[model samples]
Target: MASSVLQIVSPIKGAPKPIGPTNKKPMRPSNQLPQSLLDAARAIEKVPFHAEKHVTFQPPSRVYTMKEIGLEGCGISPIATSEPFQLFSQEAVQQCRAEIFSEPVLDKYQFSSTFTKNMIRGISAEDAPFVHALWKSPQVANAVSKVAGIELVPAFDYEIAHVNVLVNKDGEGEKAEDNVGFSWHYDSFPFVCVTMLSDCAGMTGGETALRTGDGEVRKVRGPTMGTAVILQGRYIEHAALKALGGQERTTMITPFRPKNPLIKDETVLTTCVAISDNSRLFYDYCLYRAELLQERMRLQAQWLREQKEAGAPFDTASVKKFIEEQREFLDTTLEQFI
Candidate 1:
């Protein structure tokens, strides 16, 4: 499948960077991974990562509270904007559209059953200032916080986006025959900022439908340029309604998972593991397991001591203390990942 070629636009030069503690790096094409890294990938070419059969886990019984999709419910709107909207500028929108259309999807079924073409600034521990600037904007941050009702920022704020092209064929039916992009599904990310660059005027379909907390699906079309929908995708399931009139929908989907200190530490270790071969990955994985186990043990010990001093029942308090200590450990352990 041939596609338009994407040009690696040099990241914005001389942009004011973050105030303190930055691990800055130059931006490169997503697929332009170093040859050495590509070669290293050969070790895991056919390696199967099997789970330890001895470990057992009971299914979690805690129920997630269902919330609606309006500003009161999801605390986010399907059509969203921010002050000094730089990412959705006409020039940027066209660039994003061209960028995704230029690249063919190496992995076909990345988004459930949808046929999507996407690109990212980078997807590693390293940072890309160009892409990060777009993510770190104050206006964007405010919108995100409002939706979450808490302060939530990007785990990889700048380069964490997946510039996408959701292609709904000309003659395709709105009701999908299978799950490909057409089926409603929850996103792995905590929040999803879906910016629609394609014009909805004269288009028959291609509405982005999201299932709300009330179990009703609400479909909204970005009828104008720069229209965006921000949602807690991990909570709300979404699907792209088929675009008719042979129109193609272009979107920049930036998935931002919550900032968890423990996940950051685990990511650092796992990233190191992936660099070598299957054997090295397994080694690093084991190392991480040990680190996490030690942290857990420390938390348990602390909780028991605290309970003894308080002369209180060791019930929810113990569990709560364990969780708090784990977060603190996660924050202090590894170097900053974002």
Candidate 2:
């Protein structure tokens, strides 16, 4: 389909909620994964990665020459108390945390347990101004752009701030979750900037670890508040370290990519998928089409009822014809695939 005709809604945040008949009967379990999901896994495995022996973090408030971190190196920058760092103040972080507390986190079933690791997407519309102001700073923008070899991507490029929270203070009762931290994965963006509003101080684990192309692993520590860490999203394999004890690890995870005029970068998922591989495109469109079909059926049924109540001409034949056409297409396509 043409890009203009198909309005892409992200499956990341607002996912497909199919409303149809349910089969109450219990079915046998299968060990194998779906072919489409397998295809997704395969694509993930094929992603190219490049890295070095060590990683570092600098002050994000100052503009670094290309000689220091190179035009495309991955590293971190601690929030400085001077000029540029003052842009990200204590009041800003507190306000963001407030919004985090207010917004509802996605449950295990709603999002992928493997990638998200039960982390809450803590940013909300209420925190947008602070987020926009902090991210749009020249120091923050230039530092990331140089390391990423790309021009600075504005906060408005992808409106929704991508953040994941890791809180282990509730106790080990939640230990059954294999890893409370995120699993290893690479993003689709050119670069992903991370900074801690709060750190995992005194915590056993919960470090943000990244692996290089030479098989070298580097563990980064965001020990203090306002520390910024930049990663080569599409190049390195990275994961959050699991928190062993009761500690709070709060960080802002923002992705940067070239802006798109067509696809709306409203939601985190839509923003990522819009610039990502076609595999995600297929997955999202499949779910979106199903949702659209369900809505079409509902609206048609409602129209028929209204026509009958008003004593207007009820075109039962047209409705049946539409149903037959959609059903035939869906059945044939599904049968061929299954």
Model 2: residues >4 Å from true position, as ranges? 1-87, 103-112, 117-127, 137-139, 146-150, 155-159, 169-180, 258-338
Candidate 1, residue 157: the lDDT equals 31
Score residue 7 of candidate 1 by CA lDDT: 20
Which residue pairs does candidate 1 place in steric collision? 113-180, 113-181, 114-180, 114-181, 132-158
**Best-matching candidate per lDDT:** 2
Tens-place lDDT digits, model 2, residues 1-338: 11111222221222111121122221222222234322432342111111111112244444332123222233222110111222244445554444433323222101122244323332333334445445655555665565544454643323334555554546762564664366566554435677666634566765666564355666655334555555544435567777665445566766664333112222123223322232433454355446546665675666667667777665657667666656753663353222
- For residue 118, model 2's alpha carbon misses the true position, in angstroms, by 3.7
For model 1, state the Cα shift of residue 19 in Å: 39
Which candidate number would show the highest TM-score if scored against the true structure? 1
TM-score between candidate 2 and the true structure: 0.46
Candidate 1, superposed: residue stretches over 4 Å from native? 1-66, 69-87, 97-130, 157-159, 168-170, 173-181, 212-215, 259-320, 323-338
Residue 238, model 1, lDDT:
67
> What lDDT score goes with residue 336 in model 2?
22
